[model samples]
Target chain A: MFPALLHDALTVGAVLFVLGLVGILTRRNLIVMFLSAELMLQGISVSLVAWSRYHGDFGGQALVVFVLTVAACEAAVALVFVLQAFSRTGRLDAAAWQSLRDAEVPRRIDRELPATDAAPPVWPQLTPAGVRPRRDETAEPEREHV
Target chain B: MIAALLPTGTTPLLAAAVASGTVSLWLLLPQAPGSDWLGHRRGALGLVLGVAALAALAWAGRRLGGLGDEAVFQIVSLVAIVGGAATVVTRSPVYSAIWFALALAGVAGVLLVLGAQFLGVATIVVYAGAILVMFLFVLMLAQPSGLAPYDRVSNEPLLAAIAGGVLLALLTTSIGRLSADPPACCTIPSRADAVATAPVGPAAADALAADPLARLGRELFGRHLLAVEAAGLLLLVALVGAIAVVSRGEVAEATRKGAS
Candidate 1:
């Protein structure tokens, strides 16, 4: 019975850890990543508590108190960052900021370059008389300067 | 005191039976929709099941001559695992947090059973009251979308299989090793009799009678003072860090507006 209980705890902990890992790996959204990290933290806390019980020591349980505190602190910081990012760009899609990978550049070169060229790209010229330029078309000139 | 408590054998058996019955009931209850409020039928059913499970486990422990430290540990671990899994699998974040709190409470119960009264109480105070409430707060404020059934179906099975396989391997190996050379006798003490002997009026007094708080205080203040202090400082740092993080978004937005 003892073994069975221990096995269950370990299984749950392992699942949480794995879920967190997958979330971190596959999830592009920053908020989801933060949540996944919380999952991993939870996994470790449960494991620690289990070990403490198995050994008849309070240390493991005590450590969990600190871990919870840390998790709370982490969530606060991460969410703030997420909110800030969201405000800057209306969308939360992670891929939207692919251009931010470069430290010096504020805009994506691939997106902004064609219009700022000595001549606008042929694609725009090919548009029918009534067609309007896309939203990204306006930023092309600034992109080429960088 | 130990001698006075040791004579009663049936009490432990009764406790064990009750605890086991409660656990079984919890497992057997029909899955409730996660959106139901605590007052709803499903919520009531879950609560009833939880209580039954806890009662059964507690009774089982008492009946078994009070669960040994290791047994208590395992029981708590099982509770936590079940509760945690429920939290993750549930469709509603609110329900998930509730289950998470249950798991935390179960961990505290284990600590108490193991004679780590201070740790157990602290676990409940910090985890159930502070940590889980914070999770609930975030869930409310953020309002992340409810977990879609397809999402759960797609991910849970694979995760469950991997976790189960690993756990099975570990448990099988450990059991094999232990069986090769079983221990002679129980090393852990049973507290059921002591607990049962206490007067039923005040819970705190009853707890103190079993294990005085002074001993724990001495241990904390004497040898573990440094560690305790460190933990305290860590908590302070975390609190400050959380505040900073949560407010940073607003700060950044302000700065951006000012710049513009």
Candidate 2:
């Protein structure tokens, strides 16, 4: 029973890890890439917990505690570095720092991108906060759009 | 009905799942110019394929592992996997962070179901409460007003999807080999076997519940004290290092401005 559960849980972790791998490989945004990396770590955490259960010991869980600590530290330090990179380059795109690549490597140029069909989001306007003015009952044209 | 449609063989089911998943991911991934005409239709097809792939994967898992597990485990694991996938695929980084928080919630549920009570709650408090908030702060500080062009186009999406599919197939194939019986060659010998005489399975769970937190504390402080100390030191170093780097960058920027 324990082994069956372990197998199932491990399968879930593998899916998550693969998703993260693809995201990190393809995504250009630095923050998105970091998020994908974190996702991979989450997958590892799940597998570790499952193994700990199977072993009937604290070993896997103990290691997971350390994993959590390392993840926290990595996030703190990595975010700072990301901020520095952003300040310097003024963009979150990883390709912005292509100069860091070896000279012989061909440059990454953006291919033509499709224009988004997504409409701009409209924020609801709030009424002015103050004393309510007395409405003239005789006013004409009660149309809401007007 | 669904069972009838799926192949009885695990290999075929797994292969179908992986192939469909790869295609789904490739379609959903943000790609360059030619994608516009395919737009809404492409998204629909990808969504359909993604659902089919998830179903196939779940079926494969069930076939590989014997059934009769708690329904709650299935539900939470599904939630975690789906949320993790969303976190990877969302175009906006802020939305990606939000999806990650949802994934953390699902993971916490999985942990709780797995009987790691402390780790379960701790995952929520540490990850969703602290680390996730920090991520959100960074995103707010750095994200542009609308979607950045970079977010709309990935690097080699097709290649990435194929690579991911291959990796997943390998991992799943390996995991599927595990059964209720640990193969004699791969039997795990652990501190539990050495220290405790209690029987495993349901009885082991009862033993675990009797004093899991206390036992876990003993394991950490008694056996792994040095490692715990090292982790503490690592955290402190990361703190100081982060602050140092940020301050140094500010100073350099100031100097550069002055020189200019």
Best by DockQ: 2
Per residue, candidate 2 scores C-alpha lDDT tens digits across B1-260 of 22332234677888889999999999888765456578567777998999999888777766654333567888888889888888877888999999999999888888888888889998999999988898899989998888889998899899999999999989876665444344679766654564465455564544355778887888799889999999999999999999999999999999999999
lDDT by residue for model 1 (B24-129), tens: 3233222223322432354345456545545544443333333344565657656764665455444445665677677666656655654556666866776677
| Chain A TM-scores of all predicted models | 0.63, 0.79
Give the runs in model 2 whose Cα sits over 4 Å from its true position: A114-117, A121-146, B1-8, B65-68, B180-184, B190-209
The per-model DockQ list reads 0.07, 0.58
Give candidates' CA RMSD values in order: 18.2, 5.5
Per-residue error (Å), model 1, residue B192: 20
Model 1, A9-102: lDDT tens per residue?
A: 4434554464355444434444444545666676676566555555444455556656766665566555655555666675444555777577
TM-score of each: 0.50, 0.87
Error of 1 at B30 (Å): 19
- Evaluated against the true structure, the overall lDDT of model 1 is 0.50
